[model samples]
Target: MSYPWQKLGLNADQQADSVLAAMTDGEKFAWLSGPMAIPLHKGEKIPAEAIGSAACYPSIPRLGIPAIQQSDASLGVSALGGVRPGDHATALPSSLALGAAFDPDLAETSGKLLGREAFCKGFNVQLAGGANLIREPRGGRNFEYISEDPLLTGIIAGHNVRGIQSQHVVSTVKHFALNAQETGRVVADSRLNEAALRESDLLAFELAIEIGQPGAVMPGYNLVNGEWASENPFLLSKVLKGDWQYPGWVMSDWGATHSATKAARAGLDVQSGSNLDECAWFDHPLREAVARGEIDGSYIDQMIHRILRSLFACGAIQHPAQRGTPLDYSWHQLMAQREAEQGIVLLKNAQQTLPLPPELSRLVVIGAHADQGVLAGGGSSAVTPQGCLQLEGVDFMGIQTPKVYHPSSPLAAIRRNSLAKKVDFVSGDSIEEALNSAQGCEAVIVFAQEWRSEALDAQGLDLDDHQNLLIEQLAAVHPKVIVVLQTGGAVTLPWLNKVSAVLEAWYPGSGGGEAIAGVLFGRINPAGRLPITFPASEQQLPHPKQVDPSTTTSLPGVKVKGDIFQIDYNVEGADVGYRWFERQQQKPLFPFGFGLSYTQFSYDDLQLCQSSDTVTASLTLTNCGDRSGSEVIQLYIRPTSGRYPSRLAAFRKVFLAPGESQRVSLRLEPRVIAQWETTKQLWHIVAGEYDIFQATDAATPGLCGTLTISAHAFGYRVA
Candidate 1:
């Protein structure tokens, strides 16, 4: 049976007729755009959309259709109820932290937590984080991007989207087409090669759409190929809808919708964001032109019809329960802990420093972050984790846990575990103090958290005075030294030489403390791989700091002593990521997918299956060590330098058992026979040479396969 929304509103086919039947001439005029209000947030202050009547408040209520409120969220939903913006909620960590955790279940839990918050808080939808361009590391908004690589971003974020939408709250994957560089975010035209943008940047959005089927999508403020994103039909309709069949509403970036006719024609459905919501577009000359036979009313009807369709599809009109309750915070917390425990990459495990045998009576924990929780990344995605996590020595053995309360910290498990015995907890701001306490102790674990806050990104990649010095100091004193590095992305680590073990415990959400405890004492196996390249040093990155030569403002990095920054591309077109370094034989701190395990695994029995259009490679993976663990199988297909340069073809995350072997397979797409026509801008599959590789690291290809294909051109370029 059809749902109630089908008749109350109209089915997709009858949407245009339904909208026309419901709207009068006056109503049509009012639906265009609202007028702006006074300003509020900007430079030297907080980042927020709704302020005290700031940025031109719109008259959306006059439109006949009750306007639905929306808000920005890089992490949890921060929606204010009623006509005026209300209370402030706790902000969570950025996406950079989630990327480090590298666990999908955890990501979904976070999304679920935020979605319920939106429903309870009275917001209609949230611009769920961002799927913008990760053009360069120095890009101001890089912290929001999950990874430079698209596959990793999609797999992790897709689950999060599903979690949100599954809760019946609308999640909008945002900053739509190529808003990669932040310097010129709202204005800069991202002049990128079409295929590169399609395969890398756009690929991320496409994957999210495939996985989550978001209820709405917010257009970016920038211009792609000389046109604003909200007014680009080629991007919204041709690619997102026609090809992907995305049945969701499209809203403009706050203040981004420029024209009335053009925006409506570009497949835009809602205009409640910035200018689209506040501008008096309906009464403007351009919209009047559109209504008085100068432009097609059919276009306007199409947009309004799309909006009605979205409201109906999301069940916003028919059912309240569809959007789930807001009490799932604890559930999400548990899920996050599980993911963190699972993906915290065991980078280096020397002489069994980890899983410190339970016999150790006295354990020495150093670093200020040990007792203090540091959950999630910084900036817009930030969420205030409710209560304090219990930590070792944090609770007086005789006294109930003294909640080490910090708004953003993630300290818990230890506080509860110490109930059995009094664990020694010491906080030292310097290495000497921390080392002295660790001397003659059973084990020492240092929480080396690298914090990157707003206003300024990380100044450099070195450990701070206490962190760097303490690593060498504590390792010498404590026989078992475990180092936990937490940050958005990888930092060049020289301390690897001193520490017996190193763990990349990327910002693991609210339950980070519990996850850390579980991993430390061996509750779950670590299985995350670095999505971004871990450069040998910050110097290995492009010098001028911009990833593309097309950018304007230069970013911070090593400059000419006195020069703040200058726009220049020293790496040129050749030296790009792991490709440049690995292909050229310069060693990286760690390969792209290099993560250690508690047990050893072997890859063998390489086999290949080739088709005219694709290739499939298969290999056998067996756990040869004493313990059971999981591993991520990375497949990198580098084509012979004929058409395009080398790129990552396919990747898969796999699990295995001790003394157990499993067969694994990966599929390679049609790039094998295609030379993307750069000048003419088309993909033509030509007879080709292909070099396929399957491995655990970028530098090492455990298996090699080759294939040839006939010149087979694809049917079309939907994108």
Candidate 2:
């Protein structure tokens, strides 16, 4: 049978209008709100035909509307607690890992994998695209987001969304704006000025929507500028729907909706996970408001129209998701491994200590369950793969999120690749035992981990459970020691100088173990760059310590009486990550875009040209070493008039063989150089000369040139 959407010879809007006209008031109300698919409370049962996932909205068979099955997809098709027993899905590396690769094509490929898995598992809506800027490095969910810079985050996230929607799944670019931290997220007010908000967080979403054209947008649980993000007039009514003219529906985060009439009037199209909210505001309450004439019936029709329009536009209505579809797990695993291999950043390799010699006689692998598997970030996005190690972890919204590890043994992978006569493993539980095991070995490789998750922020950047002390002690005894970090975000490396080499492997996914082995054995060269800045210490940040709410309780999913707080984002304004460091005149432990490769690369023949309002930079990048590798070409711009700090205007990753050279030309994103003028409600580019630099990273500009731009104002909406 042909689908209703396909049967109609009209466009998405007209089809949605036809569907809305045929629906009764009860059916219209049903589409506005829905409960979480998984039962949260003690006695609640999942609705019939609903898979236990993030959320589920019932279908109207009479109208041929398919049910919306939503799943949490931060890194993959997250099977929450294996809600379906014996269920497993391919897990990709953290979003930060994808960000490090600086490959939009890879991002889109990863997105397609996520979308395919979700669709096969009967999920039509995947909460996949996380575009929030990493303003707080210690944020528990930083692993879930892309990067700190707006340009990088937007382009990467945009491609990822495009990939998901391409698979006929509705992808959402989420947490709408300024949701930078998990601490006090439910009650915290993210305060920032309009101009700064436009330049940073909003800019990321704007670009992603322009490029990806995602079918849905999810607002954060927090408040933006003194109003809940789900119902904020400026954010929803003015910016997202008005200025940008986004055609998609706005869905509230779980437990985020607080009103009925206000939310509908302000542009919230749906209430997701309605059971988590104090009440199902979009149901009876909305109906009551409509009957009382507080909200016009036309507004409800508009809401239904938007939802159905997205369903038609994204092919969710035409190609409904199905259960038990066949998937190539092996091929998917290879794709995951490929991403991990490209995203592993070699932070330090003193005296060329990496690419472990094949002739090495002895080696000891220690710590972080190297014998068992590689670590993964925790929370709702956790995917329980086959043989995954589940450790007790945080509890949120009546769900236990265990710290999960994919069954990819680094020890086994290393042994398979190494020619060493003897390879040993130590759990690193006892420092004395580890030291004894490593005593006479040729080298010691310690896998250090700092697990971060949702519902809470990390206490600090230090390695927990005395791992630092262990590394410090091991460095004291061993002459050649290597440290492989499996962390969610940046950490303070106290024993930096003590280790012979250090690898920043940020929560490598399913094939992480093999990818790590490939890099260590020189089968794959490391090219991943730092997406977020690693601060020297907490003292260098905009706020030395993260702001704590006045409430006594810190646990998420629990409401404290009179609980409310404010995060003053105005302190640093839109200057995030490396930009903050440049503004403060403080050097980071490692700068953004900083990464080392086995081979050397150099930039030369810098050239610049301007056409209309756009500035284009052309440069020659050559591999100076005798090894094949990839280099991320970073282009930065700074206004000669000192309007703003240097921003990452454009970037590209290119693979070149030994002694190979490539000439690349990149056009700067207009918003990176243009300032947001609130009074004019548009982007204003001042006519001036700007300094352009072809940089190795944010802090290291290798080649310099100048470009003159013509002054002009453009509409804020991305076309």
Candidate 3:
């Protein structure tokens, strides 16, 4: 018997309707919820046919529906605790690293690598494409997210989703809305006005959905305003399903579903990892609700229709995932290395301290397990490559998630690259010992790390006092002190003036050591730019301290409940990251889009053109130094009279040889220059003169121009 999808000339929607008509209530109910594929606790049995990863929806043989096999993460195909024993996957650098590259094509390529691996491993749904804006600098999962800016996050995440879907895998652009912090995530309410929400967080999701057309969306565990995101009507129904007309299904984050009836009505199509919740709310309770007439049966059919449509649309049904499919692991490793090289942002290079002199007599490497392997972020998104070094870490929901270090030794790579007569490693556990060992060394390379994960935020931006002291001591004695940072996000550099060079290698992935070594030796020119701002200190933040939910009393618009607290996002509103710095007249230690290259670049011939709804900025960019490198040209715009400060309008990363020049034009997105009109529920561009600046970073403007746009209001086209 041929299925509706098998019939000639049937679209995804029509095919879904036909398939839905053939499903029984039990079959439909089965598709609505599923348990975590891997057992979280001892004595809990794994599902018989489960693939043992994130979650799995059993197939309906009679209806010709294939099982939805899912995997964890954004960087790579994560094998949670090695559920599938002896199985390993290639690891890409952190999402923050990808964001730093400012290359959408690279993002797509990374996504394709993840998709290919997931598919070959018998999984069709790769839980990837994390587009959440980095509102909180200390956010634990910031490494998984793309950028602080909405436009950058959206474009990169959209392309990533597009790549994943191209491999017949359904990708999810997630956490639905503002899931900024991990501390008290299940209880904290992210409070923001409609206008602010639309302009910042939602805008990112909007553009991602527009570009990626992903097959699924997953809501965060937190609450938006006063309602749980999984059951928030305004978010799931109004914005996602109503105005945007997103046709894909909505899945609840693991253990995120609170209610069966409310959530279903609010537009949550699937409840994943139901075992983690107190009960399987979407199972019997949902079926009972439909039978009692509390929920219309038609809505159930609609939910089933969405799931089936996505399956047919993304080719999950037609091309079933097959295990044991061969992959070119060596080629994948090279690609991962290339991505890491592109993302290693050079934050400081005082007097050209980097590209260490090859003929040095002695060199010493200290701290951060550099002698063993490179650091990786903790928690669910962590990819454990073969030969990884596991250290004791935090316990996340009864699971012991150890801090993993991929077996790519920076010491080994550096030794191979260096022509030093003597090369040595010191653990840096003792400052005296490290200093003693570093005595008479030609140079010193200090490796510092800050490990962040899914369940907690960093204590603060500063490196540990010991590490700080170690650097200071080393700097006082040595003339050249180069620091290599392996962190989830930005960190305080108290010893900035002392250090000669600093490279922010954000949790560089599988081939990180080689990438780091390549940059240090000038074999590869660093081109990565900062995706988030690095404040001088925590005191400069909109909220100096992250609100501890336990200590909080009450919020303006929210009803105080036991354990439930509110985060006032209205303080910063739509202005986040560098924009906040601009508004507050604060100078960050390092600004967004700031990165140093081995070579220099200069801009000229700045011009601006305006159309009915968009503005285009064009300029000639030339490489002015003696070597080849890439430059991230940033365009920022601000209205002469407006409450909002300057924002990132458009950006492009160009590569050039010495003295090579190219004219580049960037067409700004309409939403970047417009504000959300709350009452009208549309983006409104006020008629005014806007100042545009060609910038090397958010804080430094080079070439400048102005453009006048006529008054216009427009709504987004429904996907």
Candidate 4:
């Protein structure tokens, strides 16, 4: 006999409605509960049965609904162990690294590879699209996000979503809204005005959803304004579901759900996450709410409808899990290496210290156990690459704790690259020894690292574990000291002036070592740019005061007692990152979209064309230097109204051969240029002459033109 859902129609909504029509309250309640995380003894495998899942929702056998098998893929297939021993997922470059590349094509490729891996390992839902803006540089999870600019973040995340969903996997665009800081994340109320929300942070989500059309949205643990994100009506129900008209399910971040009725009312569909007790918040509570008439039965039906709709809409139901599919590790590893090579940003190349002299006789690489492997960011997004960790290194946390290193040998890769050069590796454990070894070397390249986790922010931008001292010592001895930094986000460089060259090789993935070697050996030209600003010092930051681990309050009278900490985003408003720096007139050590190429490029022949609906900026780029390289062409819009400093409107990364000239055109989406007017609850495109800045980076505007809008443009919301 055909099920009621199958009999009704083929359309996802109809199928969902039919399924909801036949389901009993008890069965629906069962569907709401989460799949269990199999407890593991120290060093024990996390059971093959739990292989494909990072978080799960129970299946309703009667309705023929399979359990939702989810995977955490912030960077790449996030898993500890899979079907067998040593079977860990492939780890790609951190999201920030991908952002640095500024290539949507690469982002999509990374997403597709990870999605394929997730599917091969039996996961239908991938939580990979993290578009949260880097409002604070020290955020523990900045590595997990794309960029500070909403447009760039959204575009990259959109491609990622498209790539993931192409494999019949549901891509989740996450942390709903305003989860900028991680210090008071779980309990903090992210207080912000609606205008700032729509113009900046929320706008990023809007664009990503508009482009990616993800199958699901995961709400963060923090609060937006006053309400918890999981139960925020304005964000989830009004903006996400109503304005954007998102046809996807909403899942709570692991342990993010607060109240059942509130969450359902606010549009949260699934409560899937870790921590059994926390995940059960929607289970028994929902049943009781429905029985007591506190919550309507329609609300429960809506929740089930959303979940079923996504499964049908995304093809998750049709493409059921396939177990025992062996992954092509070599191909995936190569892709990871390519991503690393493309994303590693060359920050400073003074006197051409990089593209190291071809036939160097002596070269010394120091710090970060580069001989063994490269580092990966910590927390839920962390993926233990196959063979990265040994049993001896596995700790009480079940695997590597605090930090995990991928088994990509940088020393071997460098040695392979420089066959003629004598490469010596130093641990840098002893500053004196490292300094001694650096003496009389042709050049010294220090592989410095700073570990970041989910719940903790960095102490400051300074490199931890005394890496600063090592760099200083090495710089003292050698004229050419190249620092290869592996960090989640921007780090202060006190010794920046002393260093000959610096490469921001953000938590490069499994094949990071090979990518580093290629860049160092001139096999690859660095094209990546800074996604976030590099402040001169911590004092220049919006919040110069360090987070007091013991203190409960951030501001006087703002008590952080109990489970509530208030984080105010009101003062800063929409000025984040470069915008903030611009408004404050504070010069950053390194500006956003800044990257040094071996070959120099020049921008000229600026042009602007505008229609009633859209505006386009076109310019010619010429490679002036001898060597071929790439340049990230950034476009910023400065309204005559002066609501805030110039905002990033558009950007394109262009590659050119020596003396090669090409005209590149970029369209400005009216929505991106418009400012959200909280007073009218609408977007206002001020009627005035606006400056269009064409530049290599945010700080440097080489070409500029003025565009005038004859009449004021207003929209209900960004479309």
Score candidate 1 by TM-score against the native.
Answer: 0.80
Q: How much RMSD separates candidate 1 from the native structure? A: 7.2
Evaluated at residue 715, the lDDT of candidate 2 is 81
lDDT tens digits, residue span 1-719, model 1: 34333465456436435545657655555444433322232322311332312121122232223344455575665321112333334334457555645556767877776666666655555668476634455444555667665666776677777777665566788878676554435555544455555666667787777777777787776676666788888788776777567777686765677776677667776564333244644456546777577668676666556555655455543434322334555665665566556657788888877765554566666664666675444333444444444232111111122222223332346435333243566665755667677866666777786654322245455667767777877766666788887765667677787888888876665567777676677666677666667777866765424433233235443232221222222232322456556555677788766777777888887776677566687888889988888877777766565344455666666667789999988786544224455555456766667677777777777777776545666634523
lDDT of 4 by residue, 109-147 (tens): 888898888788778888889989998889888999999
Looking at model 4, the pairs that clash are none
Cα misplacement distance, residue 421 of candidate 4 (Å): 3.5
Over the full model, what C-alpha lDDT does candidate 4 score relative to the true structure? Answer: 0.81
Q: In candidate 3, where is summed lDDT lowest over 10 consecutive residues?
A: 551-560
lDDT of 4 at 188: 75
**Candidate 2: tens digits of C-alpha lDDT, residues 1-719:** 55445554789898888788789988888778888888777778886768888888788898788788899976998877567888889989999999999999999999999999988988888998999999999999999999999999999999999999888899998999899888888988888999999999999999999999998999999998889999999999999999999998999998899999999999999999899999999999999999999999999988888888887887888788988999999999999999999999999999999989886899999999999999998887788898888899889778988888899899999998887889999999999999999889999999999898988688888897579999999999998899999998989999999999999889999999999999987999999999999999998988767766754355333233367777778888989999999988899999999999999998889999988666898989999999999999999999888788899999999999999999999998989888898888989888999999988899998899887888988985544
Model 2: residues >4 Å from true position, as ranges? Answer: 1-4, 550-562, 717-719
Each model's TM-score, in the order given? 0.80, 0.97, 0.98, 0.94
Which runs of model 4 end up more than 4 angstroms from their true locations? 1-9, 40-52, 60-64, 81-84, 274-279, 390-402, 547-549, 552-562, 712-719
Error of 3 at 45 (Å): 1.9
Of the candidates numbered 1 and 4, which has the greater lDDT value?
A: 4
